[model samples]
Target: MATAEADVPTAALKVERGKKAPQFKGRDRWVFYAMVGIPTGLHVLLVWVPTVGSIFLSFTDWKGIRFSDITWVGLRNYNQIFTVFEKDFFQALINNTVLLVFLFLGPTLFGMFLAYSLDKSIKGTRLYQSVFYTPVVLSLAVVGFMWQSVIYSTENGLATQLFGGGEPVDWLGNQSFLISFGDTYGISKNFAAILIAIAWRHAGYIMVLYLAGLKSVDNSLKEAASIDGANEWQTFRLVTFPTLKPINVVVAVITVIEALRAFDIIFVLNTPRKTEVLSILTTNNLLGEGGGNVGRGSAYATILFLLCLGFVIWYVTNHYKSTEEGAES
Candidate 1:
């Protein structure tokens, strides 16, 4: 009876403490509203308004000069994208896919391998890391320009001088194939050359991300695997790799985005023949450098946005569903 009576006061004290906690009143409530409302309003105005406007404009032919100029043509832009512009659209698609594959195979895997190698306390590990990471810190545009002038240039370039045999190779300008894959989608030798520079930078960036992921892994799991007579490769593949799933997802998304938006290096390289990606194609339309085609440009932009949005939505839905299932289990 006494214990039950004592528990009543403890419960009452907790309730009292809850009640005593500060609650926002009149003026404080206004401040809270202002804090949340202002940002929300700004985001709606700045981001959503433009996005909706762009989607509306995609169906219309507009010179982008005035609202009065927009004329709804109803699927004309999309029809051209499919029929008339099919070659350019398909070419950009194939090129972006090539970039995506190259980045995953070359940088993503290479970065993980590098991170695994450096996780061992090798001599001058920091120096090796710094060397690999330096390119990622440099501005891509500047790096692209440097690469163009120093390496790929036809006249007085390092590569030309080295392999010139007194006749400098036109590495960037040569449309002639070193090897053709088909009449259509074989690797362009010049495009492959540009990819070298891209991979160099991407490998370094991915290395840093993977290195951080590797650091967060528990040493005990590795030690346990070692005790089980597991070799280093077996241990990493079975035990460590699973733990790095989050980092893998992040790297995958980054690589995809990078591949899709590859521009600066290709751009600075004067968008050398057959090196076009979606971003460059989209920008060229928006700027009307290939003659004013606002409707077409907006269609491309909408396509890119929808593709990204779809991927994000799918990933988020799957991720959250799995999380909920795991929690329930």
Candidate 2:
């Protein structure tokens, strides 16, 4: 019996060594190439081609009409942006910064609070979640219209009835600066109203993201924290929050991107005066009436692109540095 068992082991080893790896040939090889190549081709064609083209076009003067009309201007468009359109540029920059700050302060924190509260498995949790999350699924354009027509309407709007105190408030049309800065740029009342609408939708999105992160947290950690006499806030700050580092990063990136690229809702609301963002400016220059100015528009686009790219680069660099330090430790 011992001899037989030893022979069986040798036979299995020989069989394993003799077995050949499978190889793809002809049809299988073509299928594998297709699986990889198709998506790569599409991504390059759709994303990189346009991006490179836009950067190239930024240095030239073009009316976006014909290739023959394209003129090599070499930084003239950028010069005009900083020199001629300085006011508009700075105003848009200020608005973008304000939106970024507001999103971080208002919706992000509120959403995290909502998510933490909802995670406790209270009664009617689903209904509460649905109520908060409903706005996230709605298009920004629709949300804009709803706010404009139903909520912020100057005449019989809900805001007028509730806060106006028998007086109608012109929420969307008010261009008066709420916080003025040196007679040049300020946060407009209209923009403030728009921010509320944006928050209504954005808070829901943040809530959903946080809720997902909360769900994945191990219950054992919470119980352990509780056993150690940690209060709710202490447990969250020390134990729960550390586990949600990935989600926090995602939320931060999304908030910054959303603030930077805010266009659709403002556009839907007819882009009130004193509320122009970089994206709105890009659209106006690129596709506005009177034969679009391709060069200047492309310049605007490149600047916006660079801002986004810079942030992403910074975040990635910081993340990797921290990761490496952690690994070394």
Q: Which candidate leads in TM-score?
A: 2
TM-scores for every candidate against the unseen true structure: 0.84, 0.86
The sequence of per-residue lDDT tens digits that candidate 1 reaches over residues 1-329 is 46555556555566546445333444555787888889999999999897777678789988778879889999888899889987678667777888889999997789889999998878998999999999999777878788888987877888888887767777776655555557765556677778888888999899999899999999999999999999999999999999998888888788888887788887877755677777777778866366477787888877777767866776688779989899778
Off by over 4 Å in 1: 1-23, 162-166, 177-181, 315-329
- List RMSD in Å for every model shown: 6.6, 7.1
Per-residue alpha-carbon lDDT of candidate 2 for residues 1-329, written as tens digits (9 for 90 to 100): 45555566555566556444323434555787888899999999999998888899999999888999888999998999899999888888889999999999999999999999999998999999999999999988899999998999999999999999999899998989999998988999999999999999999899999999999999999999999999999999999999999899989999999999999898989855889899988888866472388898889889899989977997899789989899778
lDDT agreement with native, every candidate = 0.80, 0.89
Candidate 2 ranges beyond 4 A from true positions: 1-23, 314-329
10 residues in a row with least lDDT, candidate 2: 18-27
